[model samples]
Target: MPAESDLCSLLALGPRPGRDAREGACNHGQVTADEVFFREWQARAAGETRSLARARALAEVLGVLPAGVPVLVVVGSKGKGTAATYASACLAAAGLRVGTVTSPGLRGNRDRIRVNGQAVSEAEFASLAERLERAIGSLPPRTGGYLAPTGLFTLSGVVQARERGADALVLEAGMGGLGDEVSLFRPEVVAITPIFSEHVGVLGDTPAAIATEKAGVVDALTRHVVSAPQTPAVAEALERTVEARTRKKGLVEYVEIADVPQEHLPPGLVQRAAQVGCSAALRLLEGEGLALPDAERLEAVLSTVVLPGRLSWHRVPGADTEVLADCAINGTGVAMALVTARERWANIDHVVLCLPDHKDLDGAIAALGALPVTFVRLPYERLRFTRPLPSSWEVIEAAELTPDRLAGLGRHVVALGTVYFIGQILDLVDADTTRLFTAP
Candidate 1:
């Protein structure tokens, strides 16, 4: 492995001179040697392809992922990470060691990769990062595309799972699933969550188009499939794609809103996702001829899983104030959060937004419906790349986000933004991020 100074030099290979250095990148600071190398590795994906080729190449070079492990790939616009986490918990309860890979870590970058519901240790991640760096450097100069951060993490998660003797793997695809790096693995079961219109230009213009792309995860290797209730257009697209991809023997079950009782799940979008994930786990186990757990046992296991930043309530550390935080990156997500808040809390006093400029501000405003709104001005240290805040919106300094000060702003507040922004709030409140998969 290269020395710290040598690895820092890799930052020079970042995006073009005029391009924003923070686009799909991390902030550079007094970080560890592994973090420095990983950030530079992520920079190499600038203007490169977002496909499986580069990820496959990296896996081949490292040759670490074990074969023949039953795999489950979860793909959708939202709730994918939660669904994958739920499925992993169920599999673990069934006595199989499971490895799970989700995106946008709640506490840090390494938390996105886990085994048996626990994040990889710092030492393990550092060692894996060093190995990945060496493999990436050894690749031929003519390699088609560079490995993105998500691809590298997914590959590392696979290696960690192998080292940990995991019996199964659950991978959550980033954004729309077609051509995603996770698709490189042949999954035994594929779970689809509700589809929403997102990444307009890059993925598709409409929900139907995005559904078609995401449905590509249901390849021939997928024997059984489960999907949350979707729009008419999305359902039609998914059915068509599944029919073409798999033989007539493949079974595709579309879960309905009625399928998940309100008594069994927490309020909001998690209900639909939990139903799909639980059903998928059941189907996968049944296919393997394993004895299914009793309904009570399954429910008990599912109840322990928590989805961070999805209308989750947090009490400020050393303060009496409590706030609801949601990782709503776009308009649709914000709308869902608002609906959840109204149904659960009845009245909302204030809404705080920490989103980037490229997000759907207009849609979010429309969904807010005249509610009092405050926009947080995050410093470059927290988020390196962001456009100027609008002059018309009320702005507050990120420094004033302490618990006592936040309570002074409003009695009932809802914090909404990207996963990173919500993660900041969780850290501010000292939430127990490590216990997300297990009961308190």
Candidate 2:
């Protein structure tokens, strides 16, 4: 049978036989299944010389297509995804076709890319993946003899968005500013949210270094630069970077979160940051000849914007207790989550805490030092680092705590920290089983 036909047949048989039968034949570029074919193709691409350069060349080809559109790039230490979502929603609300790409999806792979708040269909993603695999084949080898497929994938998504004639492309940077794959496109408006310490390995050690890295998204001002309020160290670094690069090129505008009246500042700074993002979007749209209705009407819309896993809240069943889960993997986010939790639930006496491997344990402990309460550590098997608590704090296994036992402690139990752990807790709560306690 032909190679494509054989591949199709193998895939039709499903994963088990395909995995066992196609071992050696698949690796040597002999196509046995779609999965094996893609893996082989990726392996060959990895053997190329200059993957990023080739990826850039491929992007150049994609860029020349007749579907050029304005792009908005959102960069920050945290809340970039939420801000991007708000911007996309506002644009969509204004009758514009908006395509948004955000990282670290909460659910499925398709959640990373959305056009007007709707995920791309499975058929569309598969078709794009197939076309992208072909595009990678045409690129030459890199200097180190490895082809980079990540850049091609990113470019493919961008191309697909443009092909659909999207009015605006909203992209959230994956890492620090300069060398990130999202930086490949020259955005019409570049907005930077607040900065905090994160990705210490890829970004620099201090908050200032991270700020500089995030500010790398701002190039010569051929596009507008929207600066969100930042901490002293971060704001100064961003101001310097913006002035130096875009001084003679394009306009640099700063949106002061503090300037917005206190009544309009939402309940928290994260919400304020999101509000700033909406304002920036309005400004960008107005510049593009799209008029917004009014500040009050826009604020009404902004008040209802919800981004999951960032200060997201849910009510506990059969109780008045509410669970607040935020992605507090770093010092900044932890501080923010703590403050927000305290402000929202001042009288709560206990908290169910689950610390992920990525979080700063010492810092989080210190940040919560001000509160007088009990800490019940949720039982989570997926954690990379699981050990007994330090002498300073008390830890309780999630399994041992019953609804009756929990109700005896206090009227409310705040579940804070990693969203993954929160998800596990929610799953256990939904099942109405004491699995969290008995599993270990």
Q: What would the C-alpha RMSD of candidate 1 be, to one decimal place?
A: 6.4
Q: Estimate each model's TM-score.
A: 0.82, 0.69
CA displacement after TM-score superposition, residue 115 of candidate 1 (Å): 1.4
lDDT for predicted candidate 2 compared with the true structure: 0.56
Clashes of 2: 16
Writing each residue's lDDT as its tens digit, candidate 1 over 1-440 gives 11111121232232211112213333342135235335534555434454366567778886744345888899987788778887887777677888888875676656778988888876777777877778877876634454556667778888889889988899988665766767777788889988876555556778888888888877777888799978899888888888888864436688774333456565666677877876787778887887666666656766777777888988766666667889787777788888877776768878888875657776777777778787876554323335554455677766556556567656567889866567667766666666556511
* Model 2 regions more than 4 Å off: 1-51, 61-67, 142-156, 231-233, 247-252, 258-266, 295-300, 315-322, 330-358, 367-388, 391-413, 418-440
Clashing pairs in 1: none
**lDDT of all predictions:** 0.70, 0.56
- lDDT of model 1 at position 18: 15
TM-score of 1: 0.82
For each of the candidates, give the backbone clash count.
0, 16
